[model samples]
Structure formats: structure tokens, C-alpha cells
Target: MINKIVAIQGNHPSKLNSETDTSVFLAHEIQSKNYKIFYYDPKDLSVINSKVIASGFFIKFNYKDKKFFKILKKQKLNLTKCKFILIRQDPPFNLEYISATYILDTIKDKVKILNNPTSIRNVSEKLYSARYQKFMPSTIFTQNISEIKNFFKIHKKVIIKPIHSYGGNDIHLLNKFNSKLINQFIKRHDHIMCQKFLPKISKGDKRVFLINGQVCGAISRVPKHGSFLSNMSKGAKPINVQLTKTEHKISKLIAKDLKKENIFFAGIDFIDQKLNGDINVTSPTGLKTLYDLSGVNLAKIFWKELKA
Candidate 1:
């Protein structure tokens, strides 16, 4: 018999925001389809007797509840029994994250894993965009202060981001370079992504969702007053928006490439019609926010395409 379980290898459900978390949105949808939700943390994953197992709880998600989730049972589960596994953890993409992917790599053939563990292992969420630099704003990846200073000199205004962080954390927009700050940032993050600050970011950025290699839907996120970051967690507001022709073209190309790379779902951003270099394959978000804004449910598309 086919397994009816969908394992979510992620942070605990209690830590997720039902209002905007794509994992919660996805679980809520799959649960409606009668699939049991097995939620686990990366640290809970183990391999013993050649069986990959997770020490976690079966849970339920109720969007209407003040407290959104309830643990049904806590136990150890052999991951191979699950028909699907969603790697939904947020990332600093450190060693722990890599180790989890390596563990998951063992059972990828037995269970369907979104964004494929091996692919996630190989793809750096930020650095992977280097292949499409022609479609992106002028950008550089380096930890060397001298190279960063030269980039700042050329670009004038620059956006600095840690190579592994998520949700707008540790990101900075520098109008002018400060050696002390640059050195400090380098020491903390090791290597960073520096890009020409797109002044048009004040207008907002478009986050386009790709499912099974198709550009399914999109929404514009306008940064709050006096901010350049457009992440919802950073106070950016989502609004109904349509993709520009250029945006669609770039998105389609990237989507196809990601599909070839074994990535089933992704989100890419555009600022001033240029790729922002954030190809979010590792736990891509915004589906919940997109549905709320325009009533377009990519979550439905997501499951249907997977034939789950």
C-alpha cells in the first residue's frame, strides 16, 4: 500500500506563523487531502540499522485557532514510510543544514523530497544565481575587504547580504563604505553578496513563484516607508501585481534551469526588472501571502503537480 504520510523536516510547527508561513499553508492543504502530517526537526533525524528515522510528532494545523497547531502524538518514525518529505527549515545554511541534507540523501529515492536534498546540498541559495548574472543587477560575492571596497567605489550605493542568511536578517544597504563595518561583517559572515543598490526597491520587488518549473503566480512587496528591504518579515507589504514580460521571461528561464537541477519549487525576486540574485529553493515562501492577496492558490497547484 502507498504511504499516506507527508513528512515535514523542519522547525517545530509551534515556531511557524500561520498567517504567512508557506509550510503551514502547505500542511493545511495536504491535511485536507487526508495525508498525515509528520513534523520533525533536522536534529531529530537519524539513521540506525540502515533505516532513516525521525523523532517527532504527528500534528494538525488549524488556521483559525489562536494557537495554530496541536501535537497529536510524539514518536520515532521511519522516514521511508512517508510518501513525501518537505524540507521546510529556514536557513543560515550552516553545517547542521548540510548534514541533514546528507542524511536525507540516503532515502531520496524511496521518498519524494521537495527541492531534492542533493540539489539543495549543491545549490547555494544566493551563489547559485551567478549563472544568470546577465539578468541580474551588478553584483559580486567576496569576503575580501579590498574587493568589496572597489565594488562600493564602482556602485556607490551597495546592498550587503550574508551568503547564507534568510528573511532579511544581517542585510545592509551602505550609501558609503566603512572599513570597520565591512571588516566586521566579513568576520561574521565570511563571504557576502554585494550588489548595486537598486533605488527602485523603494517602489518594491516582485516575488514570482515557480512550481514544477512553471511560473504560477506572483505578488509585489512594497518596502515600508524608509526601507529598502522587501521581505515580509522585514515589514514589506504584499500587494496584487502582475509579472512584466521581462520578468516572466527571466523567471521562466530560471524555473527551467531549476527544474533541470531537480528543484520542484522556487521563488525568485526582481527589482527594477533585474534579478535580485535570491533564487529561494531552500524552503521558498510567499504562497500563503500570495493567496491572501489575489485568491490565487499555488498551494493547490503545488500538490496537484506533485500528484500527491
Candidate 2:
């Protein structure tokens, strides 16, 4: 039998925002169910004698508290002994991230990993959205400068994004194509995703939470003044918002597809009802913000669905 332990493979607590961190929120909810939370960084994970182990610490979370979370005790754990393992690391989708997934894949069957490690490795958060291109903005994934130049000629204004990045980092909006900048961006990122710039982003972008193949809730994150990036971490203010029929339909289709892919939780964004080309599977966030805005408490739904 699996122990009443949920091991989280993520960044250290100090690096997380106590105010809006979904991982801590979920961990707090799960802890209420009497499950111990074991927190660890990716570097702490290792395989010895074919056993997956992590050197981490027991942690307790309380939303009402100023500190929010406290480390209780230190321990080195055999991951297979835990009831659940959450791949909660932020992504650059670099070699180390991929290596962690490969290591976790070995013990996936032994523990209930939130997203099947093999499945997460197979899904590219941006590239996988191509499966539903009809719902997205005109987008291209390439490193070819010529193709990007031609794309700009057709689209006029475009947003350039690093394919392997997250949290609105290394994203640029080009009003007019500058070949030099495009060349440098391509060289830095290798391959990048360029999409038609959506002006409606000035209003906000809606982030929909999909848990267990169902649309649980959503919040509109309005970008800060003079910015187009709507990521909450990028200073976007989140507000409660209702989904339009088209947005709901798009979310439903993506949720069903993700469930089939064995991704138990995800977040997808929409700008003016158009898919934003990010299918956030690895460590999808926004639960705390959702709770703050709407009092819906998706963290409760998250744990309930897992238990069910």
C-alpha cells in the first residue's frame, strides 16, 4: 500500500509566491486530508540501485498564516513509497527538465504521478496546441529567418515566443519586422513560436482551469498598463470572469483531448476567444488566484477529483 505522502518535485519554497502559488494551495488542501507533503527540488532527485529517491523535507501549509508554509522535518524518501508525486517544476524545458521526466517515468506506475511523466515528456506546451490549430491565432513554429520575415509581411504585427519557456519570459512583440532582432531571437532560442499579435490582449486573457477533463473555473488576467503579457506573475491583475460559449466549447475540446493524453490537470488561455497556443500541462497554475477572485476553491476540486 502507498503511504499517505505526496511528494512534490518542484522548486524550493523560497522561490515560490506564497500569495498565488497553486502548488502550495493544493498541498495545503491535501494536507487537510491528513496527507503529509514532502517538498523537494529537481536537483534533489536521484536514482540509486534502480530506486527513485529524493532528499526533501516535510512541509505544512496554512493560507491564513503570513508565512503560509513551514518546513517540518527533513527526510530522504523513496518516491515509490508515496501515494502521489507531482511534477511541479517551472519550465525552460531544458535538458535537465527532460532528464527529470525520464527518471520519474521509471516509477510512474508505482506512484500516482499527477501528469504521467512519459505523457508530459511527449507533450510540448506550445507545439501540442497545433492539434487544434483551427482554434488558435495564425501561428508558425520555426527558426528560419526567411519564413519569419515572410510571416511578418503577411501578418504585419507578430508576437515572438521561445518555444520552451514559461511565465511570459523572453516574449517579444514586434510592430515591424526587424531582421537583426529576429535573427538574434532565433539564434538564442533555436526554434520559436511566432503568432499574429492579438490586440484584444490589452483588455485581458482568460485562463481556464481543466481538472480531470472538466472545466472547473476560469479568471481573466488583465495585463498591467503598457503591457500585453497577461501572465499573473508578469503583474497582470486577475479578476473573476465568465466564459463565452465559444470559449467554453474550445476549452471542453482541449480538456477532453488532454484527459485522453493522461494529463490530469492543465491550464489553457484565450485572447478574444482565440486559443493562445499554450496548453499548460507541466505545473499548470492559477488555483490560488481563482480562489481569491471567485472563492471557487479549485484546490478542493483538484484533490477531490484525484480521490474520486
Q: What's the TM-score of each model vs. the native?
A: 0.98, 0.98
Candidate 1 lDDT over residue span 202-247, tens digit each: 9999999999989999999999999988999999999999999999
Report lDDT per candidate. 0.93, 0.92
**lDDT (Cα, 0-100) at 205 in candidate 2:** 98
Report the lDDT of model 1 for residue 107: 93
Deviation from native of the Cα of residue 28 in model 1, angstroms? 0.7
Poorest 10 consecutive residues of model 1 by lDDT? 9-18
